[model samples]
Target: MTQAAIQVRDLCFQWPTGASVLQFCSLDVPKGEFWMLLGTNGSGKSTLLRLLAGLLQPQSGEIKISGQVGFVFQNPDHQLVMPTVGADVAFGLVEEKLSLAQIQARVHEALTAVNLQLLQRRPIYALSGGQKQRIAIAGAIARQCEILLLDEPTALLDPDTQLDLVAQVRNLVKSRGLTALWVTHRFDELNYCDGAFLLEQGRVVDRGAPEHLKQRLMQ
Candidate 1:
């Protein structure tokens, strides 16, 4: 069996208001696998992603994740801090104390992975919404993260852009052998996923191949 990239057991989380968000028996993401987290509004999709990203502490249970984790938010604007694509991609690496040449090399490799190398010096404001999201992915790649957590990353894009971004992200993740947990409510998006976990009120109700889950929903 493939080694697990992310593992959770008896995981539980509650909001400050004493409302529970996640109460799961167990969850696991095997290395190099892609799983879609499907849930409706108020179903804790984003909450789960946040917990996986270590943004919030769980009230109880355990979360074991391997390697570095990178988060790509629903809004690319939230991740882009610098003026240009190259600057934004390298923003997180500034504190790593690496030489300028090393940083440049990492930045180039990441942008090239996302097919954005030519736009490295382009202004962030000049890029389209889809391009902005790709830049966010590039930033994560530059960080050399082994796992990626995406919380409805395509929610704000147009239909065409959404499809394009999803396809690009799927390809990047597969090619890099990175594990990803993508949260989305759009059923059609599952076409680009390998497997899926369905959530309701923070509980995993079902999980299987994306096509299988879609058939179950239809029935």
Candidate 2:
């Protein structure tokens, strides 16, 4: 078996308000693979992503991640905090205590990788939704995370922007060998995923290659 980049075993979670979400959920994501998580609203897709990111603790389970992880929340506003684009991209490196020159070099490289070099000095508020999303991605890349998790990354974009973002993510995964777990309701988007898991009422009901799951769901 391939070594898993992420492993979850018998996971369970419930909100503070007594709302139960996941139960007995277990999954493993192999390194360098792109997996799409499909489910309807309130179906624990976002919750599962949070668990993978280490932002939320499972009530009763174990989650093991082999390397650093980057998470892009459903709301860009939640992830983009710095006032300027450059600062935001550099935020992750602040803890490293790198020299100013080194930070600037890494910031420039990360921005250019996402095709956001021209907007380096721009204010965050002036950016379009797609641009903001790319900036968020750039910030994640700057952190040098081996795994990227996104929750509804293209939810609010126009069709063109949506396609562009999807292509960008796919390229990131292929070129950088980054493991990705993307959660979205659009079943069509699974065409880009190597494998997929179907979530129903917080549990993984079925899982397989995208085409197989599609056929099964349709039948």
Candidate 3:
């Protein structure tokens, strides 16, 4: 069997007001593969993604993820902290003990990966929505994260940018040998994934071939 990069077994969670979000949810994404999570609103897809990213703690169950984790928010404005592209990309490395030269090298490599190296000196405010999203991705790459968790990274972009972003991520996964779990509602985005999971009422109702899941939803 293929080894899993992200593994969750019987995971459970609820809000402080007692609104249950997950009910013994379980999933496993094999190493070096790309998977998408599909669900209607309030299906606990975002909650599950946040839990996997460690942004929120589950009340019960287990989440095991190998290697470093990178999270891209649905809104890039919510995650980008620094003023400039280069500064923001390197921001995550602040907690690491790397030297200045090493940090710069990492930032360069990451920006290049996202095709944003030329905009390194650009201000965050001057960027379009698409560029800002790419910068957010570059931040994760700079951290050398082996796994990526994106919660609707294309929601705010135009149709063209959305498809482009998804294609870019697929290439990144294949070229870098990284694993990714993206939460999305757009069925068109399904074409780029290796597999997919359908979330309903906080549990995974269907999973496996992306095309199969797509057809199931359409019918």
Cα lDDT of model 1 by residue, 94-171, tens digit: 778899999999999999998999999999999998899889988989999889999899999999999998888889
Q: Highest lDDT: which candidate?
A: 3
TM-score for all predictions? 0.97, 0.95, 0.98
Best by TM-score: 3
Candidate 2, residues 1-219: lDDT per residue as tens digits?
A: 888998888889999998999988888888988888888789899999988887888889889999899998777988899999999999889888789999999899889888999999999999988899999888888888889999999998887888788778888888888888888877677788888888888788888898987887778
* Superposed model 1: Cα runs more than 4 Å off: none
lDDT of each: 0.88, 0.87, 0.94
- With a 3 Å backbone cut-off (N, CA, C), the pairs that clash in candidate 2 are none
Residue-level lDDT tens digits of model 3 in 1-219: 999999999999999999999999999999999999999988998889889988899999999999999999999999999999999998999999999999999999999999998999999999988899899889999999999999999999999999999999999999999999999999899999999999988889899898899789999
lDDT of 2: 0.87
lDDT of 1: 0.88
